[model samples]
Target chain A: MTGTGSISDIEPRLGYSLRVNGRDHEVDGAWVGDSLLRVLRDRLGLSGSKNACEQGECGSCSVRLDGRLVCSCLVLAATAVGREITTIEGIAPEDGLTDVQDAMVTEGAVQCGFCTPGLVMAIHDLLDRNPAPTALETREAISGNLCRCTGYGRIFAAVDSTVASRRDAAS
Target chain B: MSVAIPETLEEALQVAAADPEVQVLAGGTDLMVEVNFGYRRPASVCALHRIAELHAQRQDDGEVVIGAMTTYHDMERGVIAAALPGLAQAGRTVGSPQIRNAGTVGGNLATASPAGDTLPVLMALDSTVVVASVAGRREVPISDFLVGPKRNALGPGELIVEVRVPHLRGPQEFLKVGARNAMVIAVCSLALVVDLERRRVACALGSVGPTVLRAFEAEERAAQEIDWQTGRLGDPAFAPEFGRLVAAAARPIDDHRSTAGYRRHAIGVLAERALRRSA
Candidate 1:
């Protein structure tokens, strides 16, 4: 974090206010170039969202900004000001795991668990958009979240069990 | 060092005019990738998300005026899909749902990557890029707008406003040859657009050249060989010949993703397939 006497030296650090997981906080030391992923992990101490690939190619840092699922690594923290952000930490109630999380555990979907949070957030987003997603739809929904451990089979199974359980609950 | 979130296009333009070095940020799909990877470090940034004008879409007569900041997600499922299905297909082939939600048409055009999925579609449809600055507004044809790989015809302080695509009465198709299904850059791509009213057929090649290229000879030959009444090629042999001509028009070079020979061959296959699908 060495400032090379560049434009950043002339520009002062700005304050950015963000509402994350229903809690509002102001980041006074937030740099203009800091990403939402950086803010969440470092400034706010919400490390539930993993930062695997800083670029948009990997969805390990997926989060909901204004209800749209996007790679938090790609979103600038400055632009996220006043926007409601929902990370993986915000999914489950205080007392228990979310349905998706429960299904993942039941189906043994998590291996190394590095991609678990992103997968859970992505699956949550998918089921929210399409309640009764087909097998292919489920795969397509989580296509962005890559699990290098090659645990796609169990992940698909987790989605299936989640959908079936939700159907059973509804019935 | 600072981000200027302009609420209006006028304010954006004013900010741009004030600081020529200010990088304009739309969806940040491309720019942020560079920034995160330490490839780019801009002194200032002007984000256009708050400018409502850059996100609006409207239908004027037979043309679809899509604001530059419209996301790929909106393009794939909205009036854009009905207006230009090929562009919609291109939009769907872009990264994943998250990337599509943040990636924008304007950003794609501004990046002007040779493998940009939307470039060939815009070129085949004869789209126009509308840009504005403090000086004035101007429209540049898609072909003229893209100068080379990662280069566009944007001047200092100029920002893209919208894209104007005419609604033609014919079927259109876009095809891309990528290594994987999703979140992969194209090895090569092709787009075919037919205009039945004018008895014209146009094809554009992507990633096989420095810029998206129009297969002029192949387009002319296809136009002459196809039966305008039935929307079919009269001679079956013309398909392969047209494909070869399209391939011949490309100026591809060997790269890590693919070789020049493969790109030339793939563009031919894609061109022929696109033509057949459109017919």
Candidate 2:
């Protein structure tokens, strides 16, 4: 809180115990109106989730809260006291990326990479819900997320590839 | 700032009754916008996230009571889609996916935005908005809740608890003319509910005036004079008259979205299209 100027203008410090990246941690200094995205990125130093739109219009700050796909930018830190948060930084193992992340790279879905974190989080949630989804279903699932760099053909392909790979492995 | 997060309706009522300055936060969709745009400032906020009773939807004997905090996305794909297609469409037409996930029916009603996609639909549905303050709870017709554009009849500590929409045998539809296909505000919007069984119709026009309006003259004309039962509606000649009547009902003003004349024209076309589509 030192480098961050004007603590008086912000909400007071509170405490939150959330299961993040499969580990439980006691995070203190929770503000009243501060978004869960801000707490995750600024407090816990998990900077994978982007804060492109403070409103819920953009999915750059998408995260999984209690296994539900939600825009962390719109959720207050105080409201997320007893929930579980899964961000992009938590997608990797102790060393490298998960299969989805690996597929994203293999399929060339990473362009400017600004929107990739949110897209990845949203896709992860979607895949968790429906491991094998139709193309239309996949489109509907990620309709909330916005990507400025690529034309989205590659990203769609990446998701489709992951779905195919997972199915192939299951067989 | 004090944070009063109540778990139940009674507890919420008690908290709201106790504090006259408490601003009601439902889903934080509209409240967040207000704070970001500096439209509202609250020293204390009463969060209604945990009020499970207000979110319940059940047939209480005869009428369907929908909890005011229900999200728009739910309306698009489920029970609401079957019951009230027009209202469900209105909910589906609101902001992007993220916004729809966060925005609530109560938030839309409380904002009182003339351009709110749900307002005209609610008005045509003749929905009842339940407002609870420290005194007690009372139901106001949707027409009355909309005092003006972005103006409402809510008291300082009042909270919109539920919006009960009467189930009617009708062909209902909602149409909007916005600047874009998605994530755009309405230039002019219309919601038509035709209860063919009762030989009456309810027409509401929004985003064209100070408030969402019921086409009283048109409704009366259709109810009292015109006979849809004894006549033919699917004929090609019916479109023009429907358009004219719908156009006559609107009171639009020129704004950034479109011209008044354009809105009037679009309203007529939309109304006719809505009717035809429902047909």
Estimate the TM-score of every prediction: 0.97, 0.89
For each candidate, the alpha-carbon lDDT, in order, equals: 0.90, 0.78
DockQ of each: 0.69, 0.37
Please report how far candidate 2 places residue B277 from its true position, in Å.
Answer: 1.3
Model 2 stretches astray by more than 4 angstroms: A1-31, A129-136, B37-41, B220-234
Worst 10 residues of 2 chain B by lDDT: B225-234
Residue ranges of candidate 1 with Cα displaced over 4 Å: A1-11
Scored against the true structure, residue B250 in model 2 reaches a CA lDDT of 83
RMSD for each model, in Å, please? 1.8, 3.6
Q: How accurate is candidate 2 locally (lDDT)?
A: 0.78
What value does DockQ give for candidate 2? 0.37
